[model samples]
Target: MRSFFRGVFVIFFLMTASNWASASIGCGDFLRDIASPPDTIEFVGCESEPTKQGAPLTALYRVKGKDALAAELYLDKKMGVTERMKFVCCVWEVRGETFYKDKKTGLGYHIRMGSEETIHNKREEWSKIGYFYITVVHLREPL
Candidate 1:
């Protein structure tokens, strides 16, 4: 009887612990919470990259849509989350990242963002939630 009860207790504890771990806030939550545009649109998926310290970092949880529009929406949602975390929004002169592709075979690609822009911004604006970092970007108004 004692061994049976112990097994049951262990199972219960494991179940609850796993649920709590998976319940951590993620970029998908932000994408789902926002009001959708008039037309039907769906986001590809949420992705997380590890920071220098191996902390989960979500840079741009964006949908497949107009680049400028998606960027603007991402910035807005990120700002709201940061504010809720008691952090101020850190705007930058430029906030968008660029990707480069090799011309020969179009296989190689390079991703880069402004270092000067993200340095202060990341430190000041990034909010920590259960070892995850929400990296926000400034929405540059279309010129």
Candidate 2:
């Protein structure tokens, strides 16, 4: 009986391990090393957890210093019309730089792409590196 239970446990873990790999990680201060706004970026870790199932993910990156720089990115529906969102309403507008789909859920999302510059004091040496994000959203019927 003990051996049977262990086998079950192993099977369960193997089935769910892929979900863990795709799970969102707790992220923190991104681009905290930069010294100026709209300048180059040192990519830092940052991720947002969904408050509920299928909730959209949001991420932000910024550095605190003189001439500080900041940028916001989030995954959600596009500003254009969607059949799933015909009845939902919100004042906020979201637009994605590109489109993406999840392999596990097969859900499509609009993603915002941000960029950071290469860490260089010299203006000419600076170059931008891109970042991408995506999360799920399902609008509910108005109350």
Candidate 3:
């Protein structure tokens, strides 16, 4: 019993540590790759718009570089958006890079509000979405 419990604890610790390390390391890599040479990026702030659910949606971010090398992100609750009762999504644009690269890591974060059933009740229901989402962009040269 003792050995079994010890083994379980070790596995759990390793898993948790691994997850944390991965998240931070991934973000670091993302920042290094996307951030510009001088690292003089700008935070463009939030932009409000209507969501598919018909609720008010806002996106916030830090951007860098120009069109081809530029980076843009959306602000979301998981990164600390208040409200806590709406869905949130993010979009990114970078010079020479497709939107898919934005999906790589640490580019966006999301949150879902309310129960699955409640949120699914309507296509435009804001309850299924996050209250907000956060976006981040890095402008860096080739390594």
Q: Model 1 scores what on Cα lDDT?
A: 0.26
Tell me the spans in candidate 2 whose CA falls farther than 4 Å from its real position: 1-55, 59-96, 116-143
- Model 1, 1-143: lDDT tens digits are 22222222232222222112222234443323433322223343444533312223233232222232333344344332211211123222222222222233222111211111122334333322112122221111111
Q: What is the number of backbone collisions in each predicted candidate, taken in the order shown?
A: 0, 2, 25
lDDT of 3 by residue, 40-109 (tens): 3333353332232211122233322121121122212112323322221221111121121233553332
Residue lDDT tens for model 2, 38-116: 4432343434434533332333433222212222311122222221101112111123233334454433333232223
**Estimated TM-score for each candidate:** 0.25, 0.23, 0.18
Which model, 2 or 3, shows the larger lDDT? Answer: 2
| Highest TM-score model number | 1
Which pairs clash in the backbone of model 2?
40-117, 41-117
For candidate 1, give the lDDT of residue 124. 38
Q: After best superposition, candidate 2 residue 11: deviation in angstroms?
A: 39
